[model samples]
Target: MPYLVPPHIPSGRIADGAQPALTADGGLCLRPWEYTDAPAVLAAFSDPVIQRWHLRRADSEDEALDWIEQWQEAWLAETGIHWAVVRPKGGTSDGAEQLLGRVSLRSLMLGTGQAECAYWTLPAARGQGVAPRSVTAVARWAFDEIGFERLELAHSVMNAASCRVAAKSGFSLEGTRRRGHLHADGWHDMHIHARVRDDEASCVPVEGAGPGAP
Candidate 1:
């Protein structure tokens, strides 16, 4: 007999060899980040727009490499899964294939089978549906491939573009966290959005800890 208790999901760490290579329209490919991707990582974080919302910045080549290392460590520790959003056949940069953006399943709260979704896009990749497409793909993988029960997304309320992405990516607005984010300017309110295993047009706000991840 199935009791009305929290679902039990198998606990496992994210391994690059086991990670699925997800493809989408417009020739987009989501793959595990590579050591060679350091340059693109540096270039992406240097963008003021990306740095604005994504407080974590890789100031130099070494820092960029360190950033990637943390992701790998997170995977081994079962804390996060990150994918380098790439446009294999569509984008170009100085005769190289540049990263379109990055999507991550961060803040892996395994006990509750929940994780947070975060992303940052290349300046050239914005305004073209890259973020939303990548987000949707990662969300689907989180739910279907990895058996994650809940995924959350939060953005500074001032970021209208992020708000739109969250909505289009199937994350319904859960609620707001007052004075949740601290930007270069000041503390800003945050909008929390979430998608669950059987979510529909609407979703209830996550209780307790507000959805604010960095």
Candidate 2:
């Protein structure tokens, strides 16, 4: 049996090249994770909020390193990619970057031109619009550069903060899935949000949160 349409993204289109660093609103940078970031990853997973929403914890630095390695490998595999959301330590371009959050295109389905965007901001970065900024940047890249037709974002209905981030990032609320996902506490209703490539509004950054803003 033959399909009527071609794959939205051709194979090797992403796996053939190196991942590029992305700049987002509010002086944020999204880059590939490095081994040196293991400590920060450990710290993030250690946070109670992250552990709850993410449903996993890094028990040690070595485990965190493994996770970083997997993120790098995922990019090469072209199944998905993850970025470390960072803020430069000083007011200069040469300054070191501090990790504030993470954004990823997970469960990538290139043939169908779809993927799920997931993110979590550090405790200190919460309420600072880090998640939405990173998400918007990634979505633009996915749509404009990679030719993906749609991106989805889903969160537990109980996660009000995540729901707000989805809206701010231009992912429209599609609907709710009853007990769609199981968290550590058990089942929870999930809100599904999405942004399509043709939606010009999806490319616009939220007010007061555009790139390079203070």
Candidate 3:
């Protein structure tokens, strides 16, 4: 599919362009973050499960707001894209703007025609297909509207859930590297998954592509 430069920005520049807000089942909308979202974003990242899964660092409310501000700048700069997974009012039993998660496409390799995908969801949002659904939505948009020929994602082997999200989003298991990153605990092995445009329909599975896919 041909990439559509977001209506608000030109093709080559990196500012003011954005992916459209996407609606998921249950009236959830994945839309670009706003400055007003700081509080909810802080609360979402403060969850122990998200911190453990993504190895998020400690931060004060001000620091968190700064991070969100930086993300906003980057999003408008067109260097990367970030979205907040919001559960709109009156749709869910909670009746709140549940900041379920965040997803991103970054590290664009224009020469190589590739980009990296990343995401993390609150524990309350896990096991409900949120991560996979969000990842797939972004991947599709990346290919169809962002002009990427391939997408890549990496996760520590211990992050079985993330690996599963990559698979369910259509990424094929690529390979593993030993001790690629040092996290809070120690060095950990990493698995790399990739999806190329040509293989979208027949990508091969990684180690756990079935019921044990994670």
Candidate 4:
């Protein structure tokens, strides 16, 4: 079955003010992934931090292209939203559209208005509020325009930065699941956080407010 945007969602373009080229703090833009980005994606995934957090494997150029192509198809099919975090020209110290990271919402239940959120950022993008900003933008869109009732964010207990992002995005910590994933370190606990439509008032405005203020 084709994925459908919920009927209750107000009709409007999906990437309105949120265009792929749309600029956010630190000259970063959340753009749709493309096959041409395969090399950069692979390089970004090669980062030890990214691999550790996301459990990504080293991939050949062809494999990387295939992965991006699949994400493109999924986006067109409305099955989910996946975006590459790019560094805008003249913004970063290096004038390059480096792949700082990626963010996505999947396992969507439109009828029930719920989905799962996930993201990871390159080390260069860390400590700059990139993850929180990206997550906030997507979550607001999901709730206000996509008509989702709730969005869930889960992370390994050791991932303090991700936990901070969830909290900064107004997600209340729900609970922890014991032994969620078997990692090389050990069976890790998973921390779950959630944001509901009723808590829309908690969404921090995109333009104003300092870190963790919204």
Candidate 5:
């Protein structure tokens, strides 16, 4: 019998195994989500802005735990990858694991050498360059370490902030997908941004404990 999944990625194509806890410059840490992070998870998703764009929203501690579990399950199946964007210990009142935001590579089709990227920064983390910095770090890991040939980022055309994130993190505007999908507010034209392994404008990976873009 053959494996049933389509756009199938043989195990060897994902030889990188589970996502590693990557350390980026400026004390940004991208690590697998933990059950203990539920409280912060609930807090971040409470923001109306996050609610508008994302499918997950956890109003209680228990719901937040469920959200974390899904990411864990997705990891085991190799279908998606998510990370908790946190800060160094003593960097904030929450200490080392301050949940700055999230960055993910989803809809993975390693067989096609590509994946989709999504990210959001907590309301408190805005204006601090959290999204761009963390995204660049994760994109670098996706390209240099995981060997993905192409990475994609798409957002509602009306999302100017997200557009900025895409640009600052080294993705180039590919084109528009007119009325590509419907949203709560009705259909939205999507702006697609992309970066390739060999792109001249590709972002450099974040280095630890130094002054570099992360």
Candidate 6:
């Protein structure tokens, strides 16, 4: 028996190539995480705000390195891709790239053409619109370049900041899932937001991103 619908995106399309760095607004760029960034990763996990949302902490430099290694390998496995949002060399006075936050397309389903977007900003990068810009950049790459049909972003209802980022990045409010996740504090209602490829409110034309402009 043949299936009625074929896969929207074929396997190995993305995994076959190196993960490309994406350009975002405010002179920020999203690039693959490197081993040398372990210290910054460790610092990010130490921040109370980041820890509260992330639910995991790096106990040592070794743990942070492990996490970075996992992120790098996930790209080749086609399960996920994580980008380190950074202020590239010229963007900072120190002339060295500065890690600002992280954005990822997790739970990626190539056949389904969907994935979940997740992000967190370091304490110093908060209030700079880093989260929203980074997310939009990745969405462009996923939708315009890789043919992803839909991308979803979910956050705890109590997280007003996440809600705002979703809105800013043009993700529409779908609904709420009661007790969607259990956090350290307790079970909390989760807000579900989504942006489809053809959505006018979110999907915009990617400059020089090939023929598909939806």
Model 5 per-residue lDDT tens digits across residues 106-161: 89887777888888878767767677777788878888877788989998887777
Residue-wise lDDT of candidate 6 within 46-81, one digit each (tens)? 987777777788999999999999999999999999
RMSD of every candidate to native, in Å, equals: 6.2, 3.9, 6.1, 5.4, 5.2, 5.8
lDDT of each: 0.76, 0.85, 0.70, 0.71, 0.76, 0.84
RMSD of 1: 6.2
- Per-residue alpha-carbon lDDT of candidate 2 for residues 1-214, written as tens digits (9 for 90 to 100): 9999999899998989999999997888999999999999999888888888888999999999999999999998988899999996784467767788889999999999999999888877776678888999999999999999999998888888787788788899999999999998899999999999987544444543311110
lDDT at residue 185 of model 5 (Cα atoms): 86
The stretch of ten residues in a row with the least summed lDDT in candidate 2 is 205-214
TM-score of each candidate structure, all chains considered together: 0.85, 0.92, 0.82, 0.80, 0.85, 0.92
Which digits, one per residue and each the tens of the lDDT, describe model 1 over residues 1-214? 7657654454563553466678754567888888888999998877777778888678789888888888777777788888898877436645556677888998888767899999877766766777777777787777777778899999999888788778777798989999998999899999999999886523222212111123
How many residue pairs clash in all the candidates, one count each? 0, 0, 2, 0, 1, 0
Between prediction 2 and prediction 4, the one with superior TM-score is: 2
**Model 2, residue 204: what's the lDDT?**
44
By TM-score, how accurate is candidate 6? 0.92
Q: Positional deviation of 95 in candidate 3, in angstroms?
A: 4.1
- Which window of 10 residues has the lowest lDDT sum in candidate 4? 205-214
Candidate 4 lDDT over 114-163, as tens digits, reads: 78888877666677777777777777777776678889988888877677
How many clashing pairs does model 5 include? 1
Give me the displacement of residue 153 in model 3, in angstroms: 0.8
Could you give candidate 3's per-residue lDDT for residues 37-112 as a string of tens digits?
8777778667766666567743667767887787777766666778888787766787767777888878866555
User: Could you tell me how far off, in angstroms, the CA of residue 72 lies in candidate 5 after the best superposition?
Assistant: 1.1
